[model samples]
Target: MATSVGDTLEDDVVAIPWTSFCDKAFNCLVKHKHDAAGSSLRIYASDFIRVYEEILDQDLLLERCKELNPDLEVTAAYLSEHLSQGITKALKQTCTAATQEACMKIVTCNAGLLVMQLHTMISGVPFLWEFRMPAQTASDAFYRHVTLPMIVMIVGLQKQQEDLFALLNDKDSEISDYKRSGQHLSRKHLETKVFDAGRFRRETLTPKHLKDCLSNVHLNPFGSEAGLMYRKMMEAYKDITTSAREPETRSPKNHSSSNIPVEVVKETRETTTAMDVTRLEEEPKPHKVKKAKKRMRL
Candidate 1:
């Protein structure tokens, strides 16, 4: 009698040995259930089921089993164990082609419920197995999908932080340059220096001293003598103006006429024409010469 499609696939699947993987997967699932809380267990179980379903192919399983034991009608539990063993053996032989092919077939052939249960068992298998070795020993698709993105995000954030630090450093340097250009000290450096509050008080309280201090502070130390002289003159004028505003000083109109010095008024005019007087004094006076008359008796 010709074997049915399901029987044939099942026999073929059973022929492939996967005992080690099945035992490992079962133990892992039991441990997972034992360690996890009720809520967590549900989540982990669901994930495991999904992975198991994806690794076990029903159609190929039935076909393979039918080829293996055509005369014997296998029960559901037997079929399940047989498929599990086959997948485990396939993963052991070569996790690259065989495992992937088996997983793909399972996912395609099984219904949603069966797929979930199968994947639960398959995912429980250890990464490094004593019996079966993985084909591609490097990272898997799961690592790329899950672990790699997380790593990339962390590295990206670190780079951004470094860039922010660099930007802050650049800004600080620019600020320092601006302060130097403006004839001002850096705030950071200023904080480290000792300040004389008394000096600041003395300078600010007096307008003359304030002007002098401001000039000295603002002007370049290498400025021309003329600039220094101008600053001095300004300070002198401010002092005079400030002195005149004192409470004890009398107004100009209230001053007595006797307070004006006669010599001061006269000397002011003399000094005004002193240059011309000197020029006149330096000129030579004309001499009167006596001439002798010659004989004009004719």
Candidate 2:
């Protein structure tokens, strides 16, 4: 069994043993049926790897890691080396694809749980689920790898179509502080910086800067296209916020509003009036005695 440097072996380690623990855990999941085809250890490994990869690909894992160690430089290289290595090792041991997939899921879940447990132990914070990297580094990574180049390409295309729109819009300017030198800056570079700075500001500083950067009204064709994308992104953010704030249970008044209460009230009143008229008709009416008097006179 591979062990880390700081970890001390407990007495249980010697007596109960890792092998026994694994066997028990595996058996607990899949009853101790000895058939190799039915329940293999590799299944767990594969499941664990799949989950681990998914988490790694998402921003949540890096965010969680940052929460744990704020100063740690969590580069893509570091992730591939340390975390991915552990996952690969676990996966490689599995003999079958099905077994491997199962194990990957288990390992990923276990890893996340372990991180949470570790954070709790270290910081006494129960909900430290995501890790965050340094603001500047994270911004750089996001722009360089994801949004930066795209924005740069957009700006470049816009510049070719319209000269007036060449200037960085209000939204871009607010997110980024310009370092003016004698040399002119390229459209691509400016756009890249804008996107990166915007993301950085969102994560670390206030998002108010984003409004300023986006406020420039001069629309090139490319700018208009980008604006639509930006709006969609904002909508998604709004939806997330709305979902979080939405009440779990609605009020009785709200529930009743779905039915046509005004119509119901009108129907009720009409029914009452009709019943009253029917009751009046059912009552005996007084008969005139004129006909009997006339007969007596004749």
Candidate 3:
């Protein structure tokens, strides 16, 4: 059950009816029944304990803090007990089915406030977590959770990009070999242009492309016509490659030498050469032959 508070004068106190609260809640829930779910963080109640424990590990906290102050008053046992109690209380508070839904709203509405809210919920004391953390511990946690991990991810992504570029170069070489062998694509539009990474990145990172990505966040990528066509094309390519891997088996009766008759080919070439020679000779001798005919006539 949820409750709402109403405001009034200092001396006057007014209580809103429970029915009004229920009505408002129902309407609000229905309005966003079909949330877009783009760029939103979702954490289920069932996984709350694991999520909470991941950040609040007692040994890790103690080790990180101990480096700053060797005489630190907080012990591992105390930290563990404190975390256990807070987690239990937080779980009890968010045991309801709608807790996950409320989390989604909070995450999308004001993500910055989420950390504070979680601190309050887990500690059962507002802002207590802030004062407890020293500068050293806070920095270490930030580096571990945010900075270092991000650096690692960037490095991995760069390596993957290099691999992809190498693969594209190999494909370009294959296409060049085909061109050199006098093979042509059946469709002129199918010919690919040389790739320019800078231009491609500039074109892909446009505001319109960002909007398209956001708009498609909730769509099923594999449900589109382009996806179906891509699947069919891959299937055909796979079949062609599979067939190419197998050795050709030719029949003994159908020899390569018998494919064309040698005499017919020779005669055709001779006839073509003779026709060309006759035309060239006639062109040069036409005036001479005409003069000779006039002399004979005279």
Candidate 4:
């Protein structure tokens, strides 16, 4: 049985609710099922999982953190522990069959909190996952989809890494950025820092990029469950893009009488000048009205 919450630490440990976690995972799965999975992430849950897998150690995770953004203050132990707890929660809840309607049925409970004398380290985001009311849409999508999967991909972790590799070897960060963009893991590893909430913030993520990524995955000639979500997203993107471009293309073609070009107006003025000259020649002048006045003067 999982505890509803974990023990508070001297270091900041953000507590994610079991109901919330499952809801997020299920929504992610459904969204992917409607647009199938492209990725997975975890760790006692850290050491237990790490005991087997030969991926990078905490040093690499922390190294990546330091390389990408010096300002981000996260530690490998903190991240690993969080992953382990998440995995622990996921393992307990995910094993049993469940439905979207009954999503809140499972909750995550922390077994206990242990503070060691030697290796004690504190870590995690200060944001408190403090998403303001009506959280930004991009941040929400990122958390539900990209964030979780990307972490797994970055960490090279699966829900059950305990079985993937022998428990004795080591792991590195060389393959951290390989997320599944298509039939295989994507090689286009964009260098982004891990666990920076601002990085996952709405202003940073482009929905179109994610849409493109998701859409390309569905076109994987091989069968996969990336449903019409990608197609729909593309359709939506196409519709909006086409609609946006339409006005720009037609703008120059829109001509009205009031907006006649300068050349045309000049030509019309020249034609009027010729017609006035013709009318002057056709009109009779005051023939000899001055003759009588000139005779009287003589």
Among all candidates shown, the one with the greatest TM-score: 3
Which is the winner by TM-score between candidate 1 and candidate 2? 1
| TM-score, structure 3 vs. true | 0.31
Q: Mind giving the per-residue lDDT tens digits that candidate 4 earns over 1-298?
A: 2111111110011111111123322221111000002111111111111111112355654564455434445445543343333333332343334321111222222222211111111222111110011212232322322232233232322322433333212222333423332334345365433433343345446776567556644223112222222232222322332333344555444422122223322222111000000000111121222223222110
If the candidates were sorted by their TM-score against the true structure, best first, what order would they fall in? 3, 1, 2, 4
The TM-score values for the models, in the order shown, are: 0.18, 0.18, 0.31, 0.16
Model 1, 248-272: lDDT tens digits are 4776665332222333222222110
- Candidate 3 residue-wise lDDT at 156: 41
Worst 10 residues of 4 by lDDT: 271-280
lDDT-based ranking: 3, 1, 2, 4
Better of 2 and 4 by TM-score: 2
lDDT of 1: 0.29
TM-score, cand. 1: 0.18
- Of the candidates shown, which would achieve the greatest lDDT relative to the real structure? 3
Q: Write the per-residue lDDT of candidate 2 for residues 35-124, one digit (tens) a residue.
A: 112211111111111211122343544564566545443343333233322333332334234342112222213423211111111111
Task: Summarize candidate 3's per-residue lDDT along 230-290 as a digit string, tens digits.
Answer: 3333233223323333465545453332312233222221110000000001111111112
How many clashes in each candidate? 35, 40, 0, 12
Candidate 2 local distance difference test against the native: 0.27
